[model samples]
Target: MSVQLLIAQLLLLILGLIGVATAAPEKILDHGGKALLALCVTFLAAQVRPRTYLKLAPYAWGVTLLLLVLTLFAGKGAAESGGVKRWLEFGPVRFQPSELAKLGLVLQLASFFSRRGVQNKLISVTAMILLTTGLVLLEPDLGTSVLTFGLGVVVMFAAGVRFSNIGGFLLALTLLALPLADRYLSAHPYILARVFGHLGRDEQVAVGLDQIGMAHRDLQLGGLWGQGPDAPRWTYFAAHTDLIVASVGFATGLLGVTMLLFAYWLIVSTALQVAQLATRVRPMRPEIHGASILASGAMFMIVGQALVNLAVAAGLFPVTGVPLPMVSYGFSSMLTMGLAMGIIHSAMREVYRAQPALADGL
Candidate 1:
């Protein structure tokens, strides 16, 4: 196994066990079973051929587009009220189309930008990203839409798109968001509550802010050594998902949080190193360009989402439903992350396979 995969698995194992320990007895088996399943899926995904991805890149985008449209019409809300329709259910199995969209967008963007005449295709690429972002936003999932849009821009930038064009697009987006924020966010009580809380405006915000403050206190209560896995004070709403960093801090203290951050750093940095290596080999084969973009895009998504989740837990950002990658107790998230890691592993495999040829050329 690759070192990146090993580190990811180790992080997931540690966090999964922590989740199980903190969960109610009835839910313990559920958490454990899903974690095991995620591991199996991740392992199998890693074995896919890189060339297979190259061949399927176009079709992948089509499937994702279909899923996105299906989600708009048939997706279920995560909450009974005041939540957007973001999930598609099939009997006992439920999944998020947006998660799949994230991976699809990354792969599609990589394919789009890796080719020659990318400059001429700029308008089409921008339109594709905007359409995807618009679809995600229609789900009223602001966090994910922003993340998806950002990931596309990051891929474009990495592929050497002009900064001026990126700046113009972002400025236009910001202008458009202002009116929408006022019109829609004002009408959504729960969303308004979170936004108001961030802006220091509502009583509901106080509740969330207090939870964040309490999370900090919990960390302090744990100190350097933590209060232990079974500590009563570790409890909080969404403790196993959104606020898991705070839970870890409560259970394992500053030490555990530090270790978790270090693990994330290693994973992200390794991905970047792989991207850099792929770039050096780009001249030898066209596929290397796609691989480099894929590596960087995956790195951006994983690391960006992880940081956002951590920031929310730390009270640095207003709470959104963004879950910590690999560590959260959501099957959909686990599967998406697993797929991303698998693709990165495939890219890494290709890079290493080409190393001898690259060396001989030198």
Candidate 2:
């Protein structure tokens, strides 16, 4: 299973490099090098004791919070970022704290769920989600904000959080969002125009909408294989990052995107099977609930982000700034995903060692 995970990750990394090469040839070396470093971190994380993650969960979650707060106060923005505060700079390097928040929230949920005699679990968990999402939203990174919220939902679902609680909380959130969005969106017409433009209601956003319009044309040009016969044209904003899927599609066609989807499916399905096996391991099952949920939550962040990126590229949803998991050029994103998947690999390895039979198909 670890082997399969590695293969899938490598495939996606190669695809990311291809996307970069197609869109911004000069940056290929930079992204490819970061991808390699991330892959190393993935393998190293897989070798750690699975229980170590549980012990470190609190610290990891705390650090994530601290970094997110720091980002809001002094986060850096990329040339393509339009001054959105999504990164923290140190020396020559920049990192996205929001990336770590995804995994941190997962570990926090699993830790609370697997522990005993925790008071106000619901309130604390809800607060954690809202705070993390709120900070990212303040960065004006609606894409990452939504992605963070979705990651929380995935973790809670995997932890067997009650459906009524989930539903009621979401309902309350929607109520809170309407008025807040009304206030915020008016203050930030960039976001308001994006929403309106996406809905085809903003005639004032032609320049803004050009990105989406060009991406749509590029995707059509890709067809089944890509613009093979035509001079390959990749003229979309964020061509190597948020719009990497469209870039890859333009060069490699729908076949390329489908391959990416299939790779994600393989990884997620295998992880789910590991989680299922952890649930079924009889005497140890109760004790290892955290591990099971951890594995599930890990994939939720990795594969969930992948799906969101795909939806945005396919125009099935509004443009989300969420990059494809391992298939995008962000260094922090690659490293975060590498670490999450590696930790999940560690969990899966622990489970397989305990009940070897569970290792069969997975």
Candidate 3:
């Protein structure tokens, strides 16, 4: 991708994030740097062949896992807002290992599933899910953990695995997740509080559930044209980033939110088209479609996480602090997504090259 295109996209994303900046100029640079890194990493990844990517999967997973562990111990500590322990600092720069882990697991799983023999697919996918999910859950980042698991299952299904196994996996997973969910609710008082707040709990105000309530109210007030650009949403402290949906709703109303979601849906559909094209190629090998599978998973990771973040802002899901992918203010997230996009772009190029007719339009 040309620097011009990257710059343009970065600007659009920044314009949206600008609404929520506290310190204005400083936070913009911090976030912009991360976005630029994502773009750079993406271009680099796109240059590599799927086969080479497969070869590197094991190492990538290992390094990411190590970083997640180090984050638990030596992580530079979470940002000043709430101390979430989700970011790690490297000297002057801070990055989120969880974000990197998201992309890492997607690529690793694509490599893993692409190489699986039909007979061993069930066991192999199961093992990958267990290992990846365990590591992600340890990060205690529930949203990304859910996303990682979802990506693995989607790829396994696409690889022509038996539906019965997918069903069985879901059934068993439901059983396993039930207990975990119960334990989580028991331990995390805030989880239930958030849910209760969403349900219009009156007593929640004293316990700080008022944020959800206030956000919901703000959504209602954003009817039609909204409060206009850069409008204040007192309900959200930094309305542009974490509470973006509500932020947009407050400014542009329902129309802006609709457009944003539509853009995401379009990107996701494009990625699916790429995957379908790659899967239909002649002389098919697992490696041949590896890039496409990774691309599809990457799209899901971004779209799915963004939806979750939006849902939280809309008071649907409990807040997990996940950003709105390319639209959010965080630097690490922007860069990570740019990197993922670069990989997806690479896959698209490869798929197009295989068929000149399709290549022309792109």
Candidate 4:
């Protein structure tokens, strides 16, 4: 098997085992089925040529935008008890459009930047990014909104947008966001509670803080080798989802956590290397530059989400409902990640095919 496929499978195996140990039998079976479907989707996507993807990029973004609109009007509420509408239910299948929006935005931005006219259309590109990001924020998924925006920023940076321009835009955004946040927080006090609840003000906030503290304690209890699956003190909620890293720590200790992180590091390192190689080739194709940007953006999304999830699980950051990339039990997230990996693989294939000499040297 290729390194990408091998590492992905191993990560899925680890997550599957965690599901079986922590979740219901039927849920574990469902996770397995979804994972298999994701693998098949990824396999098919990997076969798509770079030219085909470019042809299909606009349609994909249209569909993604349409889904976001549908979600805004008729989407289901949060899986847990909350008023947020982030998922769309089609018969028995439910998925998050915001997840699809991530890729759509990345591809659109990559295509926009790969062309020679990027320098003249910065305003238009920024408007597009803000519009899509605004729609996501309306989903009331603060985490996904922030992530999508950050990915856009990274893509622009990779495309050689100046630091002064980026900084000025961010400053203006922050200034505009402050009043909006204050107004929104005034209406929805619970949001503020999540941010400042550790201060012992509200019951819900206290419970959230307590959960973080307990997660910390659980990690301490695991020590170097872990307490195994049947440990009596494993009390963290969402142990198989947002808190999977904590679950791993409780069951397999720091060693398992380290190994899991190392796998993520390897995947990201390979992606960056592929992107660098794509950039280093002489007389590079425009499509290759676009592919490199796509690969880098995908890596940032996966690695960034993993880091955020780990920070939340470790009680070092505010709870953002971010799931660990391959380890978390969300079908939408899994499918999105699978598609990203496939795209990266396709990009790598194109790079190597364009430079047979480089391929031979590797």
Candidate 5:
């Protein structure tokens, strides 16, 4: 499809969702952020040149790294919840540098692979992971840390990391992570409670049981067609962002949830198709830099984060305050993700288009 048509569809879907959610009016401003971000993304889609992105990657990575350092030194010393410092206040707006870092890291890796086949792409990727993850972990933003790290591994995998190596790395990661979880659980009562709940421990289950119990109540309240858009998800107060799927379940019922899932599946599937097509041709093969691999990476980052956030809201995992991509109510998340989508869209625009022959030039 043409880029303009694609952008229109995205705008329609996003705006439609926001309008639907606002009918009952929980947090309209937050949903508006989605629209605002999409607008910025659309503009960026037209402005950025693909070749320029190759040069921008190094600067992007450097700036992201510098932001990470600034967060440690001057970020809001502590969030309301704990020692985590994910936000840096710019008078009125709070910025999450890690979000930018996720994109920067992707661009960096893409640029590296586009140049020469690096024998140790995995090692280079891991170094980048540690640099970003270490900074995020210090902020105690475990959710973004996991998301960013996961994105890095995925990009490396796309660059053709051996499966055997991936297996070993994952195993090592699992071992290292377990002890951290254990230490965290030991250090914080809330962490212990959450871990215990996740582990199905009876004692700590009640800490968050009210939300679960209420969600079930909301589920039962919704019949086949649902309570309708006018129905308010008051019981699920965090519904608009963190527990949005539950809100959909409550307000629009199971069918709405099914449709939402189907829609995203379509988006991701379309991305995969573009990637696959890009992998086949030659003149525009490098264009695949923004297509299959980077597109896949972006989808993974967005969808993966949504699933994790949803799982936490469902009490399947400990709450980590991660927002649902495109659906969530955060300026940084919406805009950054929109920007990343624009980058991918630019890649797709050139994906199957015929490139000018080199000899024909002159």
Candidate 6:
């Protein structure tokens, strides 16, 4: 599973290199270097025990929350982001806490679910998800917000929490969100525009003239075989980050994109396999099995966010700026996913080491 996961990441990183090089040459070197650093972190994380990740889950989650809150007041983003505070700068490094929150919440939720007789487990998980989601949403990052929420939901359902219970909590959440609607109205015009415009509910907005429109044109220009690196294309903001798939489509064409999709399939499948192995090690309350929960949460987040990014680029969903994991050109995503991949590796290692008999399943 780790081998395949590595292969998948390498392929995606290569895709990132190609996409960034083609659309944003200035960012290619930085992208490559950071990707390498992230992979290094993953390899290093594998050296740690799975139980270590469990022990650290609470700390990780707490720190992530602190970061998320900190970002709201002190974070800064690219000029194109239109003053959205999503990143915190430190000396020479800056990153998005929301990205880190994805993995942090995953580990934290998994830890909570695994422990037996924890009171209000469901509510705890919901609060964690809500807090993380709310912060990202306040950043007005619709894409990461959806991804974080989806991660918690997947973990909750897998933990065997019933639908009715989920719905009840969701309703309560709705009540909480009702009062915050003005935040969206006052601070998220960009988000509202993308969503409403895509649905054709807004008549005054020129919907098709934005970056997404250019992304669509880039895809069409690539055709079945793609136009290669030298293709004539209009560069758009976030071509290397949010709209990377289209960049890949433009440079590599359908064939390249198909390969990219296959890479994702391999990755998601490998993650499932890892999760399966981990679950087997702790058949009863597998969530307590740190590696098992880690694998499961990581797999869901990867596939869920990947699907959203693909849908948006394919014109099936609104542009939500969700970066394709391992494939997007951003330090925060690269490092966060690197940690996820690393901890995932640790989980597999812990499982195999703890139960040598289970190694045969792999």
Question: Which candidate should be chosen as best, given lDDT against the real structure?
Answer: 2
Model 4 residue runs over 4 Å out of place are: 1-5, 23-26, 78-82, 198-204, 230-235, 359-362
Question: Whose lDDT is higher: candidate 2's or candidate 5's?
Answer: 2
lDDT string for model 1 (198-278, tens) is 767887667756767766777687689787778786356777777777767767878888878887787787677667777
Q: Write down the TM-score for model 6.
A: 0.90
Model 1's alpha-carbon lDDT is: 0.76
User: For model 4, what is the C-alpha lDDT against the true structure?
Assistant: 0.75
All models, RMSD in angstroms: 2.6, 2.4, 3.6, 2.3, 4.4, 2.6
Candidate 1 stretches with Cα past 4 Å from truth are 23-25, 78-80, 175-181, 187-189, 357-362
CA lDDT, candidate 5, residue 218 = 65
lDDT of 2 by residue, 25-123 (tens): 888999989999998999899988667787788899999999999998899887766667888999998889999998888888777777742234578
**Better TM-score candidate (2, 5):** 2
Of the two candidates 3 and 4, the one with more favorable TM-score, higher being better, is 4
Stronger candidate by TM-score (4 vs 6): 4
By summed lDDT, the worst window of 10 consecutive residues in model 3 runs over 17-26
lDDT of 6 by residue, 1-362 (tens): 37877887788888889998888888788988998998898888878776677778899999999999999899898787787888899999988898889998988877777674324547667778988888888886877887888788877766556788878877887898889787777776877776788877885554553677788888888889888876667877778888888899899888878888888887667666666665566444443365667877877777688899888877788877778888888898888777777776776666666667876755
- The stretch of ten residues in a row with the least summed lDDT in candidate 6 is 281-290
- After superposing all C-alphas onto the true structure, candidate 2 shows an RMSD in angstroms of 2.4
Error of 3 at 260 (Å): 1.5
Question: TM-score for each prediction?
Answer: 0.91, 0.92, 0.84, 0.91, 0.84, 0.90
Error of 6 at 57 (Å): 1.3
TM-score of 5: 0.84
Q: Give the per-residue lDDT of model 3 (tens digit) for 21-69.
A: 4213356566666655666676786787667777788788778888888
Return the lDDT, model 4, position 5: 49
